[model samples]
Target: MVATTASTGALPPDLFDTTTLVSLAATLVLLGAGYAASRQFLPKDAKNSARVLFVWHAFDALIHLILEASYLYHCFFSWIPASSVTAEDLGSSQFYMPQPSPFLGHADRIYGPQAGAIHGNALAKLWMVYARADHRWAGPDLVVISLELLTVFIAAPMAIWICYDLSMRRSRANVLMLIVATGELYGGFMTFCPEWLVLSENLDCSNFMYKWVYIVFFNTLWVWLPLYAMYVAISEISDAFAVRDALAKVKKSN
Candidate 1:
């Protein structure tokens, strides 16, 4: 069985060793510079900026949902076309035998039955980003993947509805938008708290960027964004009730 099979006891060597660190630093500098440029060139009104940001945020989230869903669908279902399979040979079968690759195959081992050996294997290092976020759970791949699926199916639609409402009802929508944006930003931070803690406790895992940065940061939205949505929903419902009460009082007076 693939689960019991021992790997070659090796890792995919760092593709960028020295150059990677330099590139990473350069990327951060560019991001910082871009943000500064936007702030300087873009208009300073809070309302206008928030409106633009909300639209972009919604679209960004949508794109992320699509890409992640594609990854998951390919990972668990082995649905990618034969030509896309990376193996070198037909290996006595016409159908492409799904061997593990960096994106899809690794997820099955980490989140599926073969997780025990996968946990200790060097290949697992690639998943350090997600692992660092929820090390206490010892298995976040399934949870994270599930959440990503939910985001694609559920959260993305809700975000769209909220965005639509914002575009239509400026005052009310702006309030909800602010609330959601606050929640998103806060949740984004909370998602990474686990990674920060993990790095503090285990410096070895810090070597992998996924472990300390991307995993928790990327996967955490499913956990927090829902809370924000709920808050907005409750507030909207309460406001509706208030309007009903006000109309009833006016009719009685008349």
Candidate 2:
């Protein structure tokens, strides 16, 4: 069945409703609590901000692997029915059809009009909720999907490892963070710039939640935070090199 529409015939409640706001608020609170808890496990001399950074990376990794991966899985795999008989029963004669199961297909029917329903699964339905909120994501943009797949599968795991290494004061952490941050910065720009250049008609900057929260906050966070992480990585690398250079000079002089 199609997703239920709002009574006013404007949009579904899940599109840009209070649930989105609550989810965002709860996420922020959970991140804050995680940071606070991380601080207790940190070295006594650790900087206050380091705890927050650790938690951020940890959360980033979790989101990439769990949330983004789920989206990606549903994007590709959910199209294939569990059983051939089910596809045949659904009126498809093909053996390997790219269609959602009966239940998700019903959701697709209900919610598909609000946003593009590429797959007929709960995850795809949830994806459409965000899509309806941000017009930029209203369709199944293959470019965006490919980028997300790379980010979720490759970059996210790297971020998780970097977080662990940084917490343990590993020497390679800065270099790894530099790499990940560069990828993030590039990914953020690529995800938006092409669409903007094409004069995207799908962009739905109608209100505060869609314009500011979903589009601005969600996208820019990757840009700004990754930029900052790159800066930190560079500074740390520079400092280490400077220290090594000084030590080498002193040894030569002696």
Candidate 3:
């Protein structure tokens, strides 16, 4: 799949130069839309909390964009700015060269079979393949990275919001909650399924904690949190609908 390939293989090197700015703009626009939607539909009293959540998502998206942009820059520039690099910089660097992780101690923080199934694992493979095959990881790598991050940071949130709204108006917060929770649980499972393959198929992981505990646990959060949020939204919408019905009955009686 294209997801398993690196941008170094297809895209031109110049793309990463403005990646940060482009992502920042896109994130801002999305956040703005969320804020506007809340203002249009939500009661004034409810706007604050919703707005806060929106802000959080906006920030998170920006962070995600930054992370990927940084990765792309590193892939092209062969060096990252010291201030922006995370602890995983080492892993990222090795991944750039398509090297298996040297930080087995941190593998739990990063590797897995589920990752291999997701565009994320495919993305890593693309880089690895490019590095190993004497080919550049470029266009395909960009698509893979963008697709994976978009689902986690953007599409997931929107899905949750939709589910939440539907539940709330229908007085089905409980159902919404279940949906959010289950989706997250499922998403996490999906995320990890590929890692088992990555490990067993190639004997890639050298550290248990880094691969299983850290990577599995933390990445699962993205799937879970959004699902939960959608559940809350559904419950709220359900309440709104009930109130509307009660008022309609009162009008009919009068």
Candidate 4:
């Protein structure tokens, strides 16, 4: 991933480049489509809260599986071309090199780099495009990668299952949603806090999209939404317990 370039005291030409625009557009389109589809397909009898939960978690699960999972796969399995420079040799260099073709069962030699650069899969390259926009994510950050691995592999599927249970109106869904919401809230904070605390200098606030949209809004969405889910879960659970208590009292009186 390309980091901050030498400060020319002027804005970088590629600050909000074509890649960023494309990515932003694709994200918005996907989100809009996913929400609309969920609204259309979910049972009309379902509660509004249930519908919202289904849409959000369904979207989250798909993103984790399709987008974040791809990043994780490339992080572990992306092969550097034999003729390309190793990661160690390319330390802190501003030069951008195209990553080799993604490993799709077998490597495609035709698209693989012949020399002088490390390569990642198609998804990884897409991720790199976003990462390169921010100084904090220039290279592979192990902390973020580790968290993503868990989220993509475990939490995402669990969220999908919870959504299904919620659609069925299972009382246990509240507990599961609480659990998933906690994980999301924790993951969201851990994803960026350490970097902000320790590597604040590397942060690039040069671009409005990178700073506000990507760093602040995109990341905090998980935080706020998860918190809301957790609130709903708690309220539902408390109501359930209160009803149970009332039933018990009536039985005792009888």
Q: Give the number of the best model, judged by lDDT.
A: 4
How do all models score by TM-score? 0.41, 0.73, 0.39, 0.77
TM-score of 3: 0.39
Q: For model 1, how does the per-residue alpha-carbon lDDT over 122-216 read when each residue is reduced to its tens digit? A: 22232222233234222323434554565567555655655555544454554555554555555445444544655433222333353334434
lDDT of 3 at 63: 36
Weakest 10 consecutive residues of candidate 1 by summed lDDT:
90-99
lDDT of 3 at 125: 36
Write down the lDDT that model 3 would get. 0.42
Ten-residue stretch with the least lDDT total in model 4: 108-117
Off by over 4 Å in 3: 1-55, 72-146, 149-209
Q: Rank the candidate models, highest lDDT first.
A: 4, 2, 1, 3
Model 4: lDDT to the true structure = 0.64
Question: How many clashing pairs does model 2 include?
Answer: 5
* After superposition, candidate 2 runs with Cα above 4 Å error: 1-22, 29-37, 80-125, 136-139
User: Which lDDT tens digits does candidate 2 get at residues 1-254?
Assistant: 01122334344345545545655664576567557646754566765445555676776776677556766665544443243234353331112112333434443421221122333344444454566444333333556677887899889889778777767777687788788888888888787777667664445555555556667787787877777777777888899999999999999999
lDDT of each structure? 0.43, 0.59, 0.42, 0.64
Instruction: Tell me which residue pairs clash in candidate 1.
Output: 128-211, 129-210, 129-211
TM-score comparison, 3 vs 4, better candidate: 4
